[model samples]
Target chain A: MLTVNNLHASVDGKAILRGINLKVNPGEIHAIMGPNGSGKSTLANVLAGRDNYEVTSGEVVFQDQNLLEMEPEIRAREGVFLAFQYPVEIPGVSNLYLLKAAINSVKKHRGEEELDAMTFLKLIKEKAALVEMKQEFLYRSVNEGFSGGEKKRNEILQMALLEPHLSILDETDSGLDIDALKIVAHGVNTLRNESRSMLVVTHYQRLLDYIVPDYVHVLAHGKIIRSGDKSLALELEAKGYGWIEDHASAA
Target chain B: MAGLKIMQVQPDTMLASGTQFYLDQFEQISDKLPGQNVDWLQSSRNNNLARFGKNGFPTQKDEDWRYTPLKPVTGKAFNLKSAPTSGVEHEDTRSQSALRPIPGLNCHRLVFVDGFPEMSMSDIAGLDGKVSVRSLSEVLAEDPETIRDLLDSVVGESSHGFAALNGALHQDGLVVMLEEGAILSMPLEVVYASNQELTLVQPRNLICLGKGAKAQIIERTVSLSDSSCLHNSVTEVILNEGSELDYYLIQDQSRSSYQVCGVWARQKESSRFSCHTVTFGGGLVRNDLRSEMTGPGAHCDMLGVYSLSAKQHVDNHTTMIHGAAHCTSNELYKGVLDQRSRSVFHGRIKVEKDAQKTDARQSNNTLLLSRDAEIDTKPQLEIYADDVKCSHGATIGQLDETSMFYLRSRGIDPDVARSMLTYAFVNDVLGQIKIEPLRDYLEKALGEQLIREKKLFGQTK
Candidate 1:
């Protein structure tokens, strides 16, 4: 579903992701675990076409199209979704209004008919329920004065509504309590399907216990040094990131 | 006058030429003016003409008009008009124009054409007998004493040049007086339309609300002519103790016209006054809003929204004075400038020494859609009382790039996203309007303006 060849990205003349390569097939869930400053979030942002992250020398292909050549909005219309670690707070723009505009925009790109207000409202109610979001939050301004957990849930609600082909979850488990982690995992698990692919990036193994991944990769110094199954996450959690750092240095 | 060599001529001589021109026009139409036979009004006009001749028109040198130049309007000659004896017989083209009647607002409509009040086009039959609504000409011809008293006291001329000119030339307007404890169920609409070239008209309106009375008045100025015209309007409001009044000043003049308006209000003890000023179209427009809280517990709220594009110029000046103790005032004014348009905002709040426990807040914000578009805003607070709370701020900026990106990332077109954010920038100020239909109309008008401006500039995709 997605391929990254020698991904080399930087910000402000400082290299962050150096010589990274990864591949994900259809229906596969890949987890990338790393310590702080390991370029986990940078990789997610670079894939989403954030302009600030300059791709020095690399190419990303998704759905038979060069994702790097497309604009952020075009990438979104082509079914690439990034659940931001910190959702933007946009005042005076209601959550429902943003969702409707986004849905209609995608529909227009796909040559599909736009949904009317009544039809859109029904869809929003159902999707909002999947993430356990209250109806009042949908009417409020998008993430303005919202709690951390509520913002995370709202992101999942958007993911469910968009139904993207490839979803990148960047630190969605961070700043979330146990209950919030469970809710977020439940929403992700419900959306799992045979044709969908997800790249889950996290610093902890707790999220893997809920939405168990097919493959686990340990990223160190901007390179994937270890690959294993779900048991690898538990072994690393019991030990520590220092053990991986020592092994990666020896290799 | 031009025979006098341009550079060799003294500045005072040059200024006198402009003022003398209006004084000569007044002399030709003095007999046709309202309250001509009244001794006090005649004297008032004479005194105001003399004052205007001395002050002439304000220049960029004046601190209040430093950011707004007057050469565009004052450099040209105008043909002053007197009251039209009979109502205009032209087809009512308002149905096709942008000035549509606000739906669901039961209003008493008054129409004026070329500066003359048209009784045939007005609808005063719905007004209760208790509320007195009369054309300024009728009142001046029959009961001149009432207006004479107001002009001598509350609605007197100010030192502003255009206001003095209006005082010398104003012949027809609306006179609405309410008795004590009276409440108007319907709003009063005053519509002014100009249909002449190089013509100048000054319309004066007087509103007097007795104690405990409540009323709402909307004044809209528009032009149907394709040629250049000028509208110098003045509105005077007097709110007695416990009275409430909501006044709306809407200016949508033709692009070839120049408009200047002045609103002066006085509030008694415990009275409340609110004014909403909306400016949409004009070649060069200026509005002056001045209010004084003379009684304890008086409250005033002033809000404004303006959108300008192309070569349009709009200036807004507001002043609130707390003369008594326990008074409060709030003000918010926002504008969007596109193309080569320019806007100026000056808001001042003064709390006197005797006015304790006064709370005043003022904010002015501007969004520039083009690099060439300019905004000069100043919010001033002068508090002399120790127990007063006064705060003022002004911000001038472009659209937020982060917010723009957020909207674009949702697969929305960049142009549509830009227009939506522009509308949202000024939506809060419009949300304060209590009249639902008026608010809806303004929102639609502003939204269309954003779209039109985006198309004109061919914004980035």
Candidate 2:
């Protein structure tokens, strides 16, 4: 469902992602774990199409099309969603209005009839319940004055509404309490389907316990050095990223 | 006589001098004005002409005209085209051109061309037996009871030199009145056209709300002149006791045109007055808004917003005097300056000693998009009473970097993200605009200023 080949990216004069390759099929979840300065978040941002990072040499294919050729809004329309570590706070734009616009943008891309105000209200009510978000949160400006936990949960709620074919979670678990974690995890679980795919990027394995990735790859210096099953997360937890680095160098 | 009158009508101020030709060519039309109408009005114009003959034009030495000097305008005069400007029927705005009616506006509608009314550009279905619509000349011919006595009474007749000159030379404007306790269902919208070639129009409007009456008046002053023209306009409003009035001023003259606009509002006991000024065009624009709350429970809301680019200049000065106890006034003026453009905001709220329990608030917020662009903002509050609640605040800054970074991080290109954040900042003020269509157009226009650059922004993905 997602393929990134020879992804060499940089910012300013320094290189970040160097000669990277990754692929994930349907019903599969991939967790990219790395220590600080490991380009873990950079890979997520690159996939999300942030322009600040220059992709020097790479080709990203999503669903057999040139993903890099599409605009960010078009990528969203094509069922590509990114859950940010820090969501943007749009002061004058209401959360509900922004969500509705996002949904409508994707829907219009799919040639679907736009939802009316009444239908939108009903849809939001059900989704808000999934994330434990009150209706008042929707009425206020997007991400404005929201608590840290609320911001993370709101990101998940957007992911759920978008129902993207390939969703990237960039540290969505950071700053979240255990209950918020569970609620967000529950939302992810509910959204899991046979055709959907996810790339979960994190610095720790705690988030993996909830979403439970099918595969774990240890990324170091912008390249994945090791790959394994769920046990790799636990093993790394028991030890640390330093063991992986030392072991890779010794080999 | 034509050449001499043109020279005599030359503007004596910098703001006026830029378009002094409009006054110069408009010399012939002066005869059409000062009709043999009301004796009081005729004598008043004579008094104004004599007063103007003595003063000539105010200089920097004058107290009120200190910030603005007029020597440049008086140096030379251009011919003011006598014929009404033609071929300016449509505006060249990028957005959709549709006129929508505003419900709940209470008054009769009168449209104007240059300074005179052209019967072709008006919608008069809203006026029936309760109200009447006529040209300024027609008003002189058939004087109504209320309209005759109050024509130039509140305007700067003897005191204000330009106003006196306009009274002596004023051509046409709108006259509206409502019966006591009458509630108007539709607002009266007055459209003034500055379309004639090389035309200069000095327009004036007089509106009176009878006792216990409610009315709304909107002046949409637009000039499509690509050449240099001038539009100097003034309006005076009088609200009787227990009356309510809402006035809206939408100015979109040509970028080469210059305008000096002023409005004076006086409220009686329990009368409510609100004026919303939306200025988006003109080469140089200066507006003076003054209101007096003379009765308890009388309320006033003064709101303004100006968006300009290129060499456009917008200057606004507002004064709200609290004369009676338990009265309230609130003011908010926001501006966006781009390119080498400039904007000035000076607001003053005065609370008298006897005006206790007076609640007043004033705020001025401006955003400078370019380093070369400049805005001067000053919010003034004078409290003679210790028991009044008065507050004033002003802020000038660029867009928030954090918000811009956050948006860009969301996969939005940096430029697109910056534009979004800029829209959000101005929308914080636009959100208060009560009217939907005007708000919608202004919103699109303001946002267009950001992304409508000559070059393309960075492409995403």
Candidate 3:
């Protein structure tokens, strides 16, 4: 579903991602594990077409299209969704209103009919129950003064509403508690299908217990040094990321 | 005759030339002025005209007029029209006024054509004895003493040049008086419309709320003609002890018309006075609103919203004075500028030496939709008492980039996202409107404006 060939990205003339490569097939969930300052978030942001991230070299292809050539919004309409590490607070814009606009925009791009207010409400109500989010949260400003757990749940709600084919969960589990983690994981598991793909980026192995990944890649110093299966998470959690860093440098 | 003498000494400069033209025009029709037999009314006009001679058109050199240049509006000479003798009715006045009526709001209409009140078009039938509505010219002939007292007591000070000019040349206006303890559920609507070219109309409005009385007054200024015209108006509101007054002024003029309006109010002990000024049109518009809290526990609230497009310019200056102890005042002014339009907001809060325990807050915010659009905002707070609490803030910028990106990344089109974010920026002020219908009307109007101006959105520069 997605391919990154020697992805080299920089921000403000500073190299962040250097010669990184990764591939994800359809219906498979891939986990990218790394410590702080490891270019994991940079890769996620670059894939979403953030303006500040300059792709110095390399190319990214998604669903037979050159993803780097598209604008951020065009990438979104084309089924690329990035759940931000820290979601923005847009005061005065109700969540329901934004969700409706998002759903309609993607639908229009796919040549589908637009949903009216009543129909949209029914759809959102069902989706809200999947994440256990209260209906009142949809009427308030988007993430304005929302708790950390509420923000993550709202992100999942948006992902469910848009139904993006390729979703990048950028540190979505960093701020969630045990209960919120279970709910978010359940929401993501429910949306999994044969044609959908996900790249779960996280720093800890606790999240893997909930949303198990088919493959695990440890990113150190902007390069993927090791790739393994779900058991690799438990092994890394037991030995810590320091072991991997030393092994990579010695090699 | 005395006003004519002021014109004789005029120099060839534009400032003097414009002032002399108005003085000469006033001299031509001075003898036929209304309330001619009343000594106080005659003397008041003479004194105001003399004041105009001392204070000519304000220039950019003045501190208050530094950001807003009056040359574009004051350089030309406009002919002042006389009051209509008979009631004049027009189809446009009846139909155009209904285009943006506040649904579910019970309001009385007092239509003015060319500064003269049209009785036939006004709806003053249901008013009881507690309220009195009459044209200024009618009051001058019927009850000259009361008109003289109202003007003498309330309209005493003139802070700017326009107020003096309006005082001297105003032919007629609306006089609304509410008796003590009378509360009118319906809002008094004042609609001013004109269709003349190069015509200047000065309408004066006098509103007096007796002790413990409550009322709402809405003044809407609309020009039906596409020709160049000017509407220089002055409204004086007197709120007695324990009285409450809600005043609203909406200015939506033609492209070529100019509006310079002043609303001066004075509140007595424990009285409440609130004013809302909304400006959406006119080539050049300026509103000077001032409220003085004279007695203890008096409260004053001033709110404004202005949207300027193209080459239109609007300046709003507001002043809140806490003259007594334990008074409170709050002011908020917001503007949205598009194209090369320019806007200015100057808010002044003054707490006197004897006014202790005074609480005052003022904020001015503006959103520049285009690179060329500009806004000049200043908040001046003067607190003489040590125990008073006063704070002011001002901000001017484009939309938040992060918020814009968040909206766009949600699969919304860039243009639609920009407009939606801009709409939310002004929703803070729009949501404060207590009248539901007016709030909805303004919301719809503002939304259409943001959508129609494609260039104003999606471009941070």
Give per-residue CA lDDT, model 1, range B1-461, as digits (tens).
96773323224323336677788888798888877678887888888788888898888999998988887677666666764735343655742373456677778889887888766667878677668888888888898887666763654555489888888788688889998988888888899877776778788889999999999888988876556778988888999999999998888888878998888999999999999999998889999998999999999999999999998999999999999999999999999888899999999899999999999999999988888899988887888899988988888888877777677766767777887788778888888888788788788888787777777654573
Candidate 1 residue pairs in clash (backbone atoms < 3 Å): none
Off by over 4 Å in 2: A1-27, A34-39, A49-80, A100-139, A193-195, A218-227, A238-251, B1-28, B50-108, B123-136, B144-149, B153-164, B224-227, B400-423, B435-461
**What's the CA error at residue A188 for candidate 3, in Å?**
1.6
DockQ of 1: 0.54
- lDDT by residue (tens digit), candidate 3, B1-461: 75552322123323546777778877998776677887888888888889887887788888888988787578766767765635333455534553345666678888887777766667878887898888888899998888667784665655787888887777788898889999876888888876666678888889999999998888888876566778999889999999999888878788678899988889999999989888887989988898999999999989888877889899898989999999999898888888899998889888999999999999998988888898888888888899998989998878777777777778887788877887788788778776676778777777776777776553531
Model 2 Cα lDDT, one tens digit per residue, A41-108: 88987887766778899899999999887756667778888888888777876788777866766677
Positional deviation of B72 in candidate 3, in angstroms?
1.1
List candidate 3 segments past 4 Å from native: B1-16, B31-39, B83-99, B118-122, B458-461
Locate the minimum summed-lDDT window of 10 residues in model 2 chain B.
B94-103
Determine which window of 10 residues in candidate 3 chain A has minimal summed lDDT.
A44-53
Best-to-worst ranking by DockQ: 3, 1, 2
What is the docking quality class of candidate 2? acceptable
Residue B11 CA displacement from its true place in model 3, Å: 18
Note the residue pairs that clash in candidate 3.
Answer: none
What tier of docking accuracy does candidate 1 attain?
medium
Residue A146 displacement (Å), model 2? 3.7
Candidate 1 segments exceeding 4 Å error? B1-17, B83-95, B118-121, B155-158, B455-461
lDDT of 1 by residue, A1-251 (tens): 99989999899989988988888888989999989888899899898877688999988999889999988888888888888888888877778888998899999899999999999999999999999999999999889999999999998999898888888999999899999999999999998999999999999999999989999988887878788889989989999999988988897
